[model samples]
Structure formats: C-alpha cells, structure tokens
Target: MQGKRSNQIVQNTAFLYFRMLLSMGIGLYASRIVLEVLGVEDFGVFNVVGGVVSMLTFLNNSLSSASQRFLTFELGKNNIMELSKVFNISVSIHLAIAGLVVLLAETVGLWFLYHKLSIPPERFDAALWVYHFCVLTAFFGILQAPYIAMIISREEMSLFAYISILETVLRLLIVYLLKVIMFDKLSLYGILTFSVSFFIFLLYWQLCRKRFVETRIKHFIWDRKRYIQILSFSGWVLNGNLAVVGYTQGVNILLNIFFGPAVNAARGIAFQLQNAVNNFSYNFQKAMNPQITKSYASGDMGLMHRLVFVSSKVTFFLTLIPCIPILIETNFFLEKWLGKFPDHTISFVRISVLITIISALSYSMIVSIHSTGTIKKFQLWEANILLMIVPISYFLLKKGGTPEVAYWTTLVLMIIAQSARVVIVSKAIDFKLYTYFNEVILRILLGLPLCLILPYWVFVNMNEGWSRLIILVVVVCISVGLSFYFLVCSKSEQRILNKVGFGFVAKFQALISRYSLNK
Candidate 1:
C-alpha cells in the first residue's frame, strides 16, 4: 500500500509539473505577442474589464473549492450516494449563481463600466465588447465545477494537464486569428479568445461526464440537505474569497481610478508574471489537494501530515530557486522581452515575490484546515486581516505613496493574515508552524545568500549578452549543486535517491549488472 501510494504521488506530481510548464510557458510566450498585438491602451482596457469579472468570479471560485472537497471526501469514505447528491446539488447551485452573475453584469456591471471605470470615450464601445464576452465566458465556465471535481477526486490529473495545454494552444491560435482577421481590434480579440475558452472548458467537462461513471449527471439527484451542507461550508469560504478579491482586484480598480488604463496595463504585466511564477508551485498543491482531502476523510492523518510537510518544503524551494534569477534580472527581462519597461512592473514583481514566499509556507496549514473542516474560525480571522489592507492601502496612496508602497502594504497584510491563520490552525491541530519551519525554512534562509551571490557575480562580471548567458549558466550550475548538497541532500534524501536509482544501492546494482555472468 505504501509503495502504491508513493507511485500515485509521483504520478500526480509529474502531471502537475507538465501542466505547469505548458500553461505558464504558453502564457510567458504569448504575453509578448499579446502586448505587441493589442498595444498598451487596448491591453489595459481588456485587463481592467477582466479584473472586474475576476472580482465577481471570486464568489464562485471558493464554492467550486467546496465542491472539490466534498467530492473527494465522499469518494474516500466510499459513499457513492452522497457523492452523487453533492454533484447534483453543486451543479444546480452553480447554474443559479451563474445566471445571477450574468444578470448583475448586464445591469450593475454596466453602470460601473461607464461611471466608475476610467475609460476614454473612444474606447468605451470596445471595452463594452470585452466586458460582455467576459461575462458570457464566466457564465459557461462556472457550470463545469462538478465535472472538474470528479476528475480531481479520481486523481486523473494528466487529463487536467492535457486540458491546460490544449487551452493554451487554442488561445495562441486565437492570437493568430486576431493578426489575420481582427487586426488591431484588441477588444474583439479578447472576446473571441474568451468564447473559445468557454467552449473548450465545456467540451472537457462533457468528455469527462461521458467517460467516467462518477461524472454522469444522471446518477445525481437534487438533495436539499446536501445543498445546505455545501452552502454552509462555503459561506465562511466565501468570506475569505471576498476578502482576497477585494484586496487584489480591488487594488487594480483603485489603480484605474487614481491613474488610468495605461497604469492598469503595467499592473497587469506584473500580476500575470507573478501569477505565472505562483502557478508553478501552486500546481503541486492543487494536485495534492484531493489526496490530502481523501486521506483526511479516511482517518489517515499520518499520510496527510507527511504530504503537508513535503508540499511545504518542495514548494518553498521551487519558488525560491527561480525567484533569485528573476529578482536580479527583472529589468533586463522586461526590456528584452516586452520591447520596453512596463511602469511599476519591476517593483510589483519584487514585493509580490516576498508576499508569495510568505504565503507559500502557509498553504500547508491552510490545506490542513480545509481537510479537517476546521477552517470556519480561521476564515473570519483571515478575512478581517485581509480587510485591513483596503484602508491601509488607501491611506498610504492618499498620503502620496507610489505603487511600490501599495505593493508592500499589501504584502505585509498577506503575511499578517497568513500568520494569524497558522496560529489558529496550530491551536486546533496541536501542531506548531515551527515544526515544518524548523526543518525547511532554514534551507531557504541559508541558501538564499548563495542564490543572490551567484547571480550578482554573473551580472557584474558579464557585460556582453553572450558572456552574460555563459556566466548565468555557470552560476546556476554551481549554485544549485552546492545548495542541494549542503541545504537539501541528507540521509532521508539518500533513501529516496536509492528508489530513483541515484544512491549506493543503485550504484551497487549497476556494478553487479556490468559484471554479471549473463554478460
């Protein structure tokens, strides 16, 4: 059973890695094309409009999380009937919610568009087109929660990886179409791409329903009790979602109000880059969420605890390793790739990286809270802490602080919120945050000096582009090799190394095979 579980984990992790590479890779490449195609103004228009939709999507996002959790838990408990009921109830609720959102977008969202948003009169119609299509896309996208939940529950993560790749390829194809057909109509380009995305999501969901028994909608029946249970769990979840969206998208909106669409475009670039980096680590957590939920349901706290710690450690290192280079080379990267420096994007990336490092450590605790159904109390505390950002951010900006100040303020709020959450969970679970920190955090803290020193040496010693490239390669090799040896590789690591044919047993096996009598 242990070996089987280990294999399952490796398979899941491999799927997540591929998915992250494909999705984030496409995003990074396509962002350059998109900026060139749309130019600054329209690109800003699209992001500003999309940010509004993101705020609304927050309501359904957390609810979808609830759907995934309940589905995984029921499957783990071997309660097929309850799982079916959850499926139907969740779908029914989402359909209702999606309808209401469309109605609100048409009415309230429209009013805010003309009045609250800082759009030039010339761009109004184009922005409206983008907004309408975004609303439609979101409506259709929300209905796939049950199918997505089913896939996660069954641990068919490779399917998700394929879907991410397919979606990205389709979006790139849309970009090509924009070049040929739409020309400079960035609004229409956004609308067309969103329409295409909706169709792709629906197609995947339909395929899952047809292929998997657990996904068949016919097996599901509406149950009021199930509806109540999901909603009750999701209510506190909604508070956290609202708080997060308020601070994140709300900050974008605030930027639009204070500055203009151009500034929002700069903010968009920084956010997309931050999101791309974050998704690299987040994909692992997302893939493990179902397994974590299942383990919690089945009373396997030991495995759950092990997964939690491993996730924290691996996520930290993965995020930290790439971030050093990104931090050091931010201006060079932006200028080289985007043809110009996006305003405030560099500072936003810097402060946001700090926020991500703090938040990544807290994800393990958050997972424990979600799995054990002890998230209710923490939700309120977390939400309150997040809410403090709004007033503090406003006051700082009003006092003439730049975007950098706002970014740091936001980061501090996130750290405080995450720390409060860890404390709450520690009280409930009787496991200190320091337990994981003492083991993993030191590697990150100590290795970071090497991360910085190597990169700084490369940047300083290399003047020419080719020389810089060579120096970067050398520095990366030496830095990572030394860091792994001193910071991460240990006896326990050796045991895993043996399993993967890299340790003493592996060397012994290779020697025996080389000198075997069969030869």
Candidate 2:
C-alpha cells in the first residue's frame, strides 16, 4: 500500500507539473497580449470590475471546499453509496446557491459598478460588460461544484489537468479572437470567453456523470436538517470569503478608487505574478488533498501527520525556488513579457510574493486542520482578522499615501491570522507549532538569505537584455538546488535514490533478459 501510494503521488505530481507549465505558458502569452491590447487603464478597470463580481463566488467556492471534504472523507471510508448521496446533496445545494448569486448579480451588480468602484464614466460600459460575462461564468462554475469535487475525491487528476489545460487554451483563443476582430463590443469578448468556460464545465459535468456512479442525481430532496447544516457551514464560509474578498478584491477596488486605473494596472501585474507563483504550490496540494482526507477518515493519524509535514516542506521549497528569479528580474520579465508599466510594479510584486509565501505556508496548516472537524474555530478567528482587513486596508491605503501601503496592511493582517491559526492548529491537532516552524519555517528563513543574494547580485552585475533573464534563472536554479541539498534533503531521500539505483541497472537487466531469450 505504501509503495502504491508513493507511485500514485509521483504520477499525480507529474500531471500537476505538466498542468502548471501549460497554464504558465498561457499566462505568459496572455499577459503580454492583454497588456498590449487593453492598455493599463482598461486592463485595470476590467480587473477592478471583475474583482467586485468575484466576491459573489465566495460562497460557491467555500461550499465546494465543504463538499470536497465530505466527498473525500466518504471515499476514504470506501462508502461508495454514501459518496453518491453526498455528491447529489452538494450539487443540489450548490445549484440553489448559484441561482441566488445570479439573481443578486443582475439586480445589485449595476449599482456596484456605478458607486463602489472607481471606473470612469467612459469606461463604465466596458467594465459592466466584463462583470456581466464573469457573472455568467461564475454561475456556470458554481453549478459544476460537485463534478469538480468528485474528480478530486477519485484522484482522477489527469482528467482535471486536461480540463484545465483546455480551459486555458480556450481562454487564450478568445483573447486572440478579440484582438484580431478588434470588436468594439468589448463585453462580447467577455461573454464569449466565459461562455466557452461554461461549456467546458458542462463537458466536465457530463464526464463526471459517465465516470462516477456516485455522481448520479436521483430523486433526492434536501433534508431541512442537512440544509441548515450546509447553510450554517456556508454562513461561516461566507464570512471567510468576505474576508478574502476584502483582502484581495477589496484592496484592488480601494487602489482603483484612490490611486486610479494606472496603479491598479501595476497591482494587476503583481497579482498575476503572485497567482502564477501560487499555481506551482497549488499543484502539489491538489494532488495530496484526497490522500489527506483518506488518511484522516481511516484514523491513520500517523500517516496524516507525516503527509501534512512533508507537504508543507515540499510546497514551501517548490514555491521559494522560482520566486528568486521573479524578484530579481521583475522589471525585465515584466517589460520583456508584458511591456513597461507603472514604476511600483516591481516592488508590489516582491512584497506580495513575500506575503503570499507566508500565507501559503500557513495555508498548508489550515488544510491539515481542515481534515479534522475543527474548522469552525479556525474559521471564526480567520474571519475576524479578515473582517479587520477591509477597514484597516481602507485606512492604510487612504492615509499612508502609497499603493504599497495597501499591501503592507494585508501582510500584517495575514501574519496575525497565520499566527492565530498556528495556535488553533496546535490545540486542535496536537501538532506542535514550534516543530512546524522549526522544520518548515526555518527552511524558509534559510532560503530567504539565498533569495536575497540573487537579486543583489543581479542588480550589481547585470543590467538589461536577455542575459539578465538568463542570469536570474541560473542563479535561482543554483540557489534553490544548494538550499534544498543543505536544508531539506535527508537520509530517507538518499535511500530512495539508492533504491532507484543507477540508470544502468534496469538497462543491464533488460540486456541480460534479451540475451537469454535469443540463446
């Protein structure tokens, strides 16, 4: 079972890596095209508008998490029939929620456009169109919540990866179509892209139906008790989502309101870079999620604990490795890929990366805590901090008089939230926060010195041109390689190396078998 699990992890990791590469490739090209085509103000306007509407997705996304947790837990118990019931129940709930979100979007969305954000009158129509299309996409996505969770529970990562790649490719295709056609109706572009994504989600839903017997929606009615339970879970989740909304989308909107679209463009670039770097770690977490759920359900506390620790370390380093180049070559990479923009983008990217790294580490712990039933406690504290984020951010952005101030407020808030969660996790899971800090947190600390060195070296020596990009990449590779060798690797890793042995061992065995067959 251990060997099988190891092999499965290896396979899933490979698939995830492939998916990230594809997604990043699309991101690189798409960022360049969008930046060039839309210009800073329009691009920023789109982001601000989209960010506002995106808050509506909070409940759907949060509920999907609950669904994933329940589905994977059932799968862990090998309760196939119950898994189907959970799927149906989750889908039923999600549909109802999506309907509510759509109705809100149609009625309240326009008022949000005119009053809440900083979109200029000339750009309002364009922004509104983008928001409308995004609303439709969100609706489609929320409705497919159970299908996505089912795929994760089954560990059918390849299907998810393929679907994701197709989605990115389709999005890219839509961008190119908009560029070539040069459509005056910019909203139509938003509509087209989202409609395609919706169709793809439908395809995934159909595939889920064919693949999982448990995915069938029978004549199931919602139990008042279960409905209330789900709603109660979603209510807390809605608060958490609101916090996320405030921290992420709220910050963007605030930036737009105070700083204008140009600064928002810079923020957008920084955010894209943050999101891209985030995808690297996301791949591993997604792969391990089902395993974590299964381990917890079976009361395999030892394995579950081990998996949590290992995942944190691996994800930490995986993200840390690439961020070095990003920090070093932020301007060159941005200018080279997406052309020049506001001056503060590089700083924003660097600061945001630091915050994202810390948050991502704490998030791993959160995922582990989530496997247990103690989510509400964590959620409550996180929500409080999250709620604080908005007022604090608004004051910070308004008073500190810089875009970076907004990020600083966010960083401080995330740190407090993460620290509080550490305490919560320690009490709930009996996992020592100091041990996690010593192991995972210390590696990050050691890595920071190295990450700092590359940028300093690049700034001193290399200036401009492709060599800068090359040098940055090389330094990042060497630094990360050395850091892991010294800080992360252990005797266990070396033993695995020895078990795999030299590449020639398998080749030699094959050769001997061939000779015997011929003789």
| 1-519: candidate 1 lDDT, tens digit per residue | 755565566677778788788877778778878888888888888999988887777768878878888888998899997877787788888888889888888888888988899988988888888898899888888887667778877888888778877888888777777778844476768677777878777887778878776566764475777777888888888888888886788888888887788888888898888888788777777777777788889988767767776677667666765566677777777776687645888888787777777777777777678777767898899988887777788888888878776678888888788778767876766666687566556656766677668778878877846467557756765786567556765566546534643434565788899889578
Taking the tens digit of each residue's C-alpha lDDT, what string does model 2 give over 449-482?
7756865687678677788778767777777766
Question: lDDT score, residue 6, model 2?
Answer: 59
lDDT for residue 454 in candidate 2, whole number 0-100 = 64
Clashing pairs in 2: none
What TM-score, over all chains together, does every model reach?
Answer: 0.92, 0.92
Quantify all predictions' global Cα lDDT against the true fold.
0.77, 0.78
Candidate 1 lDDT score at position 320: 65
What value does the lDDT take at residue 261 in candidate 1?
85
Candidate 1: worst-modelled 10 consecutive residues by lDDT: 496-505
Residue-pair clashes per candidate, as listed?
Answer: 0, 0
